[model samples]
Target: MRRLAILMLLPLAACSSSAGEGTASTPAPPPTSPQAPAQPRDLTTNLAVPWAVAFLPSGDALVTERDSARVLRVTPQGQATPIGKVPGVAAAGEGGLMGIAVSPTFAQDRFIYLHFTASDDNRVVRFRYDNGIGPLQPIVTGIPKGDNHNGGRIAFGPDKYLYIATGETYKTHLAQDKKSLGGKILRVTPTGEPAPGNPFGSRVWTYGHRNVQGLAWDDQGRMYATEFGQNTYDEINRIEKGKNYGWPEVEGVGGKPEYTDPLLTWSTDEASPSGLAYAKGSLWAAALRGERLWQIPLTADGEAARPVPHFQDRYGRLRAAVQAPDGTLWITTSNKDGRGDPAQGDDRILTLPLP
Candidate 1:
């Protein structure tokens, strides 16, 4: 969900326990030094309030803009054209054109997956784009939605399954309620049915999340997610099957011993993390409230390094980030979507040099 406008106004909550424990807890480990960029480069500019971006086989970027509900085909040369429009989007507080993913087998299927909040419920749809025909078909439906805490991030995992992040929809306790779809990571087939052997035997992979917005996988095939916190800190967690990360019951780590703990936590003031991508032995998160790009170096052990902010405040609020086939980072802007001071060109897709 978008946090740029509402962030500064929300009353701050006291710092909670880091990861599941409260006070006087043992420090996990000293974070390593921040990794330096190989050589930073300013890629391109001029776009709408883009919320998400994905790369095509040809190296072109497919970007989604929130308020406008438009998708664009972006070239390395900075050229952009409207690809098509998604249907049934409800643009409000945090709802709009949210996430886009190219089919894992795009070379053959030419399918594209989208996550958006509809007038009723938030839904996932897989569609085809065959040139003349516009927005194709809806493959998944019936996800619960709320004005706040609408977790709307989707991606294809290394296992060739579609994964979805859900929020508790302002109903905090729903996070722990296994019967409901909110506040859980859902793993499903390309056709949107629960995949075989899911932890809950339902669609849920893991439960007890407040509002998860970022999903990525490391080289070792471990899944990681970024979640929005109410007041104190935002979290980065290693997602495991059947393990519950304390939500309404716990904020960061240090709530109850039974629940899984977060791998890393950052001041919400410093990070309203959204899209997450792992590449080159590191993880990158787009910071909406922090107005920066964060690069975290992961140990071979798969734990998080201290977050290092890049282009701090230079490019407005960043919403979604992804690594392209060419090894460059693709990032989108969120300024034009009723948040922050919109740059003359508040929304645009950018390419960053990765080490």
Candidate 2:
């Protein structure tokens, strides 16, 4: 068994104990840090390569299955029900139904957005969920798609504008191309129009990203994103409007004046980070290749402090990390995603208490 180590530079709070896997608490070594909470409990299991998770106003979560193109409603108590399969999803290598976001005004508009791969390209669509998914309304389209690097993650920023993250689709030059939607973070209105005050007249908010898969906002509404590097590094960037994050030109950090450097970087083996959520004064990131959950503490100035790893290799291929309405963190495993080894209840959602 791999030995677990607890290291702390700041005093972190603890969550109420709960029944779950690895429930036997590992005693802390010294008087420096508090004991880590019990291992996360399985919320739901047997999912087919679950990709993204979004919470409805009712507190139930809607989860997406990448290859199956199905949407499932998971109750707070861990019951999952397949609402419907998304139409027009072309599941291929690393591309399929990926990101889901509930409208900020979901209670009134009943709108939900999805980012998925189509037969020709990757796109974002809007649907009304009355009881089932409504007709497909394509809002954003023409994102480049390839066997890998189909950047797929979407969320509504505190500004109420929809933010879309896209990859270069392995076409390196596209990362610097302003006209192309691929390899960029786009800011658009709920109706799919270019958001007012966008640096570029088009939907492009920022450019020069390799593959961005995670987006989150801190308490002060500062934006952050996670990007995958070619082979050397993975990055957590403090997002700013119109800033260029050097991609092919600079893999990790280039002191070049024209491009913005990442706030923090990790070796690719340590963090191929995916879904990200902000809670309890920290950013929680889910790692795919590293198979861990990273909690990065933030300073008062919105800078990253130190990142602490949890559940390293405990769950296989952690994909999505989302904070539920009740403050608990919900994470999904991706063991059934073809690249991972599936366990008995492969592709499961697990819940942990936030510190």
Candidate 3:
């Protein structure tokens, strides 16, 4: 692998302020100056289809395997141990045990949450992890599921509410249905009820997404998400409360007045984006089909600058990118996910230091 160097560019006056949603605009030119080189090191190898990563308060990480439904505890020293397999996972196609999140108040609650494809639907559940996984308690349930597009990513925002990303389950009409949990980002309390200040007075935060797998928040608490586009373009969207992303109605930058546009978009061949993380004034997106990491720099005002791509084809298929508690970036590969040609030690987690 080659050394990765990021350019810290100054914000341009032409850059749109992170205000209302609009179509993808021209980005500012790349910076003339370059930062120090950052290199990625494989933290663990020979893992099954690892999907999501969450960091414990102790600096350890909890990783979920999509097909196996197993959770592994990974130490900072690169040691990986299987803690337990979540029961009742219906591993198929793009569904299974997908996302895992350590509670923001984990030190006090000892609760870890998971999103998985059950027999009937995709659901979120929590278990108290003292030394081992406790009995399961379902929080959010009845999310639509399908052989594909089983959007399953969960995280706790800075507000302490749990946010969920759900797919339309190949049912495009569901994207427009606020009453349906499919194709929407749901915000709920710890107990799975609708959050107090939710837009629709229910769990739906935003709707009209085809398949959103990545969610991240900037320092200012602004939310962003990565969505898989249907054969045309992939998107990085600046999420707002109750806004529709125009999924089946449109893809990429529609420039339609009624629907919000994406902040950035790439051709499907260049980016099947997933697992987004915010760090060092940039949004890092892991690409599955593109087999690279994209660093999208942000201005002081939170507008997006030119995006830089790194590690193209060096790693087979990148699935997840997350910022660790210690400030390093951790990413997982997805070569073993049936769509890619597996390399030696096909599925693995790699770590890189940020500038």
Candidate 4:
């Protein structure tokens, strides 16, 4: 494991002018230079179907393997040790052990949350994960599941609430139906109760989603999500509390007044976007079918500019893109996930410089 020092980017401070009398105003700082292109470094190469990674305060990480139902504790040097197996995980097409998130208060709580496919449906469970494994405590359950479209990205938001992203389960109408948890992003307490002040007085936060595979928050505390489109386009959306993103009703952009149009969209082949991370005034989206990493520059007001693609077709089918606690980005490849052709060490974690 090679260690690199990262330089933090600073914004220019506002300059104030004194009242006249030969008083000169100070000049604003020069524009910051673009970072040198990040060279991808292989952290680990011998992993099987690794999906999501969550970093601990100690700088160690917890990684999830989708098909194996295994949770691994990885050091910064990329040494992986099996912590324990999640009980009763039902691995099917596009499902299994999907997303893992550590508790924000993990030092005291010692809790880690997992979203996975079960025999009957998809669910979120929290476990007391000390260095040793403990019992799995079910939190949110009964999310509709299917062979595909089981949206399984879970994270704790800036509000300290747990957010679960769920797919519509191949049923288009579920996206528009407010009653079902399918095709919606849910906000709940750590104990799995509905968060207070939720729209419709339930756990559902936003509705009308086809399949949302990513959840991220920018520095401003604004939430963002990535969506998988049917055939025409894939999407990145700015998520609001009760807003509905047009899924079944509209695919990409709809001028319709009822639903919120996506902030950005890409061709289906160009972006089957999965995990996303907001860092350095941009959102980095990991593409699976497109097999690229996209960086979307953001304006000061939080509006998105055109996206710039990096490492196109360089790494095969990028699965997850996350900013580690150390301020560098870590990404995983998914060529071994029964989709694309796998290369030698097809499934490996790669580290990149901060955006």
Candidate 5:
């Protein structure tokens, strides 16, 4: 151990709880400061349209291959093994196998939930994971699907209910229709039933969303979602149950009576927001057209500050940004998703320390 030679005098510290009389002990030398920004590293390469990643309790990641409709169990050593195929996935433009969520009680139930585009609609299903993944059961279905704007991100909230983000599929009226699952945030149980405390007594938690692709929660258990604007504004919203988010009526902020304004908004060119993750007291939003990660520092109550962009244009078309169980930020490139130019190993999972 190195010797500590301090010039300033200090008061005597209390002895350890187990110490005898007059036996003094140095207090845990003031807890050290936190550290970050340890250079990004590619965990796995040669992925095809990787959309979202969810970690198993064992720390192996369950990654969704959007176009192929397959799930790969990616190990920490950059090795991937095909766990199994999510059945009935029909791939189309921006619609296919999209988001994944491992059960909060996965150690016992071993249930994995998946969001995918079917032949007619986008849907959610739960499947058991034994040695292989199989025996799919419908969780929620009949979300209107189209070539684009099929929002598919699922996450289990701190309340232990699954939250699903759905796009309007370019249908203008569906956003305002509470009866339709399209363009709405749906909350349900693991078995596909409406969560008990849902605002409308149905799976539709909040209506009037154009395209919501990202869902995250802060330390205070408040929810936040990233939404795609029509042609002008991209937005980050503080989601509350049963509250209306102005979509077809208002793009960004109208401050209307029936609608909740977004917490933060950006130009469409700057942030075509997709996957979002809350880590290190900030919301990290991924962009597709912007091809960058927006790090927006958030207050305890989930207020947003000026966002700082990192890894802009260096990596082409980021689609998914998530924080792994071990506190690492994992991002996926969307260059191969028929939108941007594909580089060598075009799509991949890049892991970095949360800054």
Candidate 6:
């Protein structure tokens, strides 16, 4: 509840240049595997258990490590520096330092937002970094958390609202609870107040989600989310206000009439959909258990095509995939940090140039 002074990092104009050009508005072709397109010339490697990656106003990238609780400043030249450590982070089985996003008004106020597990709950906090004085202070808190289903992803919508993703944390019914901020997308003002004009009158934007981990917006202002399913299916949903994504009631793509079905769903073994990003008019999803990058072409409406796998064995256990400031897709490997088999470099971030 402590109010902290805000600091800005990069200006809006600085971000517009890199962001507006990288992702295209045209429809992308479906991914083909039997004959993988020749790998792009630029494929930068070396990152570790990178839970999330955010682009700074200055065009650099901020990458987070789930188990390390460390926030790294990754440069365009591929050099990474430890910016600062996150506080109140509880690390363990699939729980730890999770998702991160830069404030929309980063130029005027260098505020950084983060989602991580605390001792008792998973919460969102905003802080400022000034080099000498590490992390500034807490911006928000009081989110529910558990070992397995702790959804921790945050992004800024085009309207500049901060959208937070959360999980039910084993409490299946919590997803449908309006009062509780769990298993749903939450919309809030930059300062953490419930955003005005929210569908539920509360922070809840949509409900009935299991463990939503990734979120992104297209040029057309459409929102897409990637979710981890319980047993059968993993989903890529085109999110709408007030809609419920079937969770405990129905596993993945199909569910009750009242709930909205996913735009694309993959079997559990094929995709444990985690991090997501929109690049070149297509949605790219990172899979943990599947260990591949699923490139999903979207129709103008935002419904995703059957996913096309990219870099299946080349990259180990893809965790986070974000469009970088350089117009290239930044992907993080999660083989290290104790989850998947540790690839020599285990947790490393890679850059893939887009066409």
lDDT, residue 233, candidate 1: 65
Alpha-carbon lDDT, every model: 0.76, 0.85, 0.85, 0.82, 0.82, 0.74
lDDT of 2: 0.85
- Writing each residue's lDDT as its tens digit, candidate 6 over 1-355 gives 1111112122212101111100112223435322333463323355556789898888878888888788888778878888777877889777799988888887888888888888988888888755422564654577778767788889999989999999887788998787888889999998888899999788889998988989999989999888877645667888888898877687654535887887666655566778899988788888877778878766665655445688787766777889876788877877775657775655677777766
| Per-model TM-score on C-alpha atoms | 0.89, 0.90, 0.92, 0.90, 0.89, 0.86
- What is candidate 4's CA lDDT for residue 203? 91
Q: How many residue pairs clash in each candidate?
A: 12, 0, 0, 0, 0, 13
Measured with C-alpha atoms, the lDDT of residue 194 in candidate 6 is 84
Q: Which digits, one per residue and each the tens of the lDDT, describe model 2 over residues 73-192?
A: 999999999989999999987899999999999989999999999999999999999878899899998989987889899999999999999998879899999999989999999989
Q: Which residue runs does candidate 2 get wrong by more than 4 Å?
A: 1-37
Tell me how far the alpha carbon of residue 278 in candidate 6 is from the true structure, in angstroms, after superposition: 0.5
For candidate 6, the lDDT comes to 0.74
The residue-by-residue lDDT of candidate 5 on 99-133, one tens digit each, is 99999999888999999999989999988888577
The local distance difference test score of model 5 is 0.82
Clashing pairs in 2: none
After the best TM-score superposition of candidate 3, give how far the Cα of residue 252 lies from its true spot, in angstroms.
0.9
Candidate 6 TM-score, C-alpha based: 0.86
lDDT of 4: 0.82
| Model 1 agreement with the true structure over 1-355: per-residue lDDT tens digits | 1011112344454422221101123233325565566544445566667877878888887787776777888787778888777778897767777888888888898888888889988888877766422564766676778766678888899999999888888788889999888898999888888899898778889998988988999999999998887667678888988889999888776646688878777667667788899988888988877788888778887876545678888887778889888888888777765656777655667778776
Off by over 4 Å in 4: 1-36
lDDT: worst 10-residue window of model 2: 15-24
Give each prediction's root-mean-square deviation over alpha carbons. 5.5, 8.2, 7.0, 12.2, 14.8, 11.1
The TM-score leader among the candidates is 3
Candidate 1 TM-score, true structure as reference: 0.89
